[model samples]
Target: MTTTQGLGELTAAERFRSRPLTRLQRIQRLLHKHPEISPLVVLVIASFAFQLASDRFLTASNMSLILQQVSIIGALAVGQTLVILTAGIDLSVGALMIFVSMVMGSLAGNVGLPGALALLVGFAIGMLAGLINGVLVAVVRLPPFITTLGTLSVFTALALLMSHGTSIQGDDLGSVLTFTSVPVAIGPFQLTVGVILMIAMYLALGYCLNWTSWGRHVYAVGSDEDASRLAGVRTRRVLLSVYVAAGLLVALSAWVLIGRNNAATTSAAVDANLDSITAVVIGGTSLFGGRGRLTGTFIGALTVGVFRNGLSLARVDVLYQTLAIGILIIAAVALDQWIRRTGAQR
Candidate 1:
């Protein structure tokens, strides 16, 4: 009887130990279920629908343009996805982007730094700003919304101070602008540096989130902080890492912006925080946090990009585009809630 009981106990322990799957398996399972199709698929459908709606949609010119336009915003959205995955939100990303951009432009143009070195400084500034936000929320225990909100105002003010509330021309920065202007082509199709940035970001983050131990910690922390802590996951560390990751991404986007337009403007990323949320939400990432994926963010970014490009091709007014995005963001949130409720019922 004692031997039988020991054998049964060992079997149960083994089962428990082997239960958890890697992040890739989790993503795969999600795709297999209804309502969790890769957000990228929705983006593709949206693109096709827009093409069908207008003659300009399928042209190589328009397609390349669409990809280019979404690059900077797409980069910002990358960070947003990371922070959101931890069941948190950062409302200051837009303002921080402005600050980082200002620093880059002013440093390289006025301060006489080399283009490459100036770019490095911009990323460092973004990381520092992000560190501030992370410390505020994770260490200081301030509410994520409130903490980021305060930083938003401060960062915006700082940006204004740095630029004297003026836009910086690309006059001194023309050398750097060439990087954004040059397009790499495959046969007849050309893609901008921005598009390449977005794609590279997607690949890197997807791997980190789906193939690494850090990704596991992010999911665990977001799913249930207290439980994750009890299970030996360092919840605070994960939160800090997520915020820092987001900030670094925002800085990377600053490069794309400089490269694309060759000018730096304070308003460039003003709507980024909202758009990032919209992209993540539309991508099928849960705003409430733990149940999101970067793949969804890519799709979400594409959806927005497609909507904007399609509307432009269809000759719709720009304000109407804003309204459509508003509606979509609200709808995505509602759908997330409904899904969670349904899952609970089951």
Candidate 2:
């Protein structure tokens, strides 16, 4: 055969080689395409491992308790996910929640406002906090980290000032403020309105992120802000909106906090900012941005609860649990780096 014909025939044969990939290869490709899958797998494995380690870990009542414990953190993580998706971070989310809750407490309990009005005011405060962060980051061109860090201190101080460092607890709190504690049974599990609210937020956000044009723009901005701007995306507007949305979520978390803690304490959710960020990272949301899923965040929140609950059931100390969480955070980041490298190589 002529050299050209021989080469062409060989190329045709190569194209016709339709061997299927092995199961491991298929799994790796699937994981690469969907970063959230790894976290889900980890969550399931952790649950099973905990179940084996402790008899109480697998009980329906214990699972319900875990959900309740994670609900507030999960709510905060929702907003955190949006900020991180835009290649931004908000250290002020927990502080925002506390400040808003304090507003709710002061308005309803001290100022004699109706419970409903107090709730609205609380939401407004949360939105305002978000707006400040947005303006600083999007309009003033400040780094998100710096903006939120500054706002974190500001919001915390505001909460303390507003509450005077005292928790609001009295008959003055209306049914609206206490509604989060009202429980309803679902099959074998009992759940509170707060937990339901947390789940609903995830469902709504999952749809928004996966299906909306705005969501696409968010990912685009995170992936490459300059390119997204060149493609006619309103990068600043998107960033602002994301921050605002995150603020709204934080307010909702405050509401849940009231329901969970049964009081609007200034110290409520003090660790939420770190916990939310940890859940985002461990849930397989890329800290570098442009890749993640709310479902993963949901699982990540549950995973944290599981770890704490399981460890307690297993007779581990609180200090050890904290250390374990720290270790998990480091391991998750390491895994994230490995996944990114492998995907890049692929």
Candidate 3:
């Protein structure tokens, strides 16, 4: 009986080891193991294709322009990435940013507060807004989509009321508010301070996500909240912290927005909330949560900028540019679904 059992176990092991991965399975496994790889590939292909279509697309000036254009969306995506990683979404990001920018502008331009102090207050309010969202989702057990959707309307109304539907011009906002617009030359590329700041945020957030204990908890909570809670992870606290962190990033993005647009207006980046989500999705971060990288988000944002700029350079119609992006978004989500299935099968 013992000899028969041993032989059976050996055969089972051999069969398992002999199971071969098909080509599609191999691709799925590669993407499952490294979610960022697919987006990186897409970015490379898009860049090469655009460069081929328009020589200007590869020029240093145009490259710098793309980085500049993507800065606000990229920064917003950083916060969105954190929220989505926890299986949540923040439709209020753009509204919160505009609200914060309006407050910052009013404090400095109208209330006579110093720009730096106004910025600090804006940051505090941003965290407070995030805290409210966190409380609703983490403590009250409301769905993330619903909570953010409600806040989106609330924040938008508040912004309009605060600004009285007026824009704060960059001239009245003082140098401090617009400092991110300052240009810096590096060899052949001309990048703004806002672009550099956005890049720094990515590097810092990437390090934290990959190397820190809190980051691990974030992934755990997003992966399986019940399992993580059973494992002694503070799942609720992780969720709360993620929203607050997202808020802080949104506040920072407001500064970049002001610098980029040279104004604080409620009308600026009306599509930013969706744009951030698009960047996150295109970057290979699973909407179902807990499987993504900031690098992918960065690349995704750049890809959007590239597509618009490239299409324009190629003299494609504006509507076609948007259609191209829509297609990319759909493709990214489909790819994500396929990758998620791989994990389910395993």
Q: Highest lDDT: which candidate?
A: 3
Task: Estimate the lDDT of model 1.
Answer: 0.79
Reference-based lDDT, each prediction: 0.79, 0.88, 0.92
* Residue pairs with backbone atoms closer than 3 Å in model 2 (clashes): none
lDDT of 3 by residue, 171-239 (tens): 988888898899989999999999988998899889989999999999888899999999999998999
Over 1-346, each residue of candidate 1 has an lDDT whose tens digit, in order, gives: 1223444455665665456666855554564343346456666777778878897898988777777878877888899888888888888888888788888888888888887787778888898888899999889989898999899999999999889877777877757633665688865668876678778988999899989999989978888889999999988888888888888888888777777777777867567778888888888888776787777787788788888989878899999999888887887777677666634532
Q: Point out the higher-scoring one by TM-score: 1 or 3.
A: 3
After superposition, the stretches of candidate 1 with alpha carbons farther than 4 Å from their true spots are 1-45, 174-178
Task: Residues 17-45, candidate 2: write the lDDT tens digits.
Answer: 44455686567677657877887888889
Question: Candidates' TM-scores?
Answer: 0.87, 0.92, 0.96
Best by TM-score: 3
Return the lDDT, model 1, position 86: 85
lDDT of 2: 0.88
Query: Which residue pairs in candidate 1 have backbone atoms (N, alpha carbon, C) closer than 3 angstroms, thus clashing?
Result: none
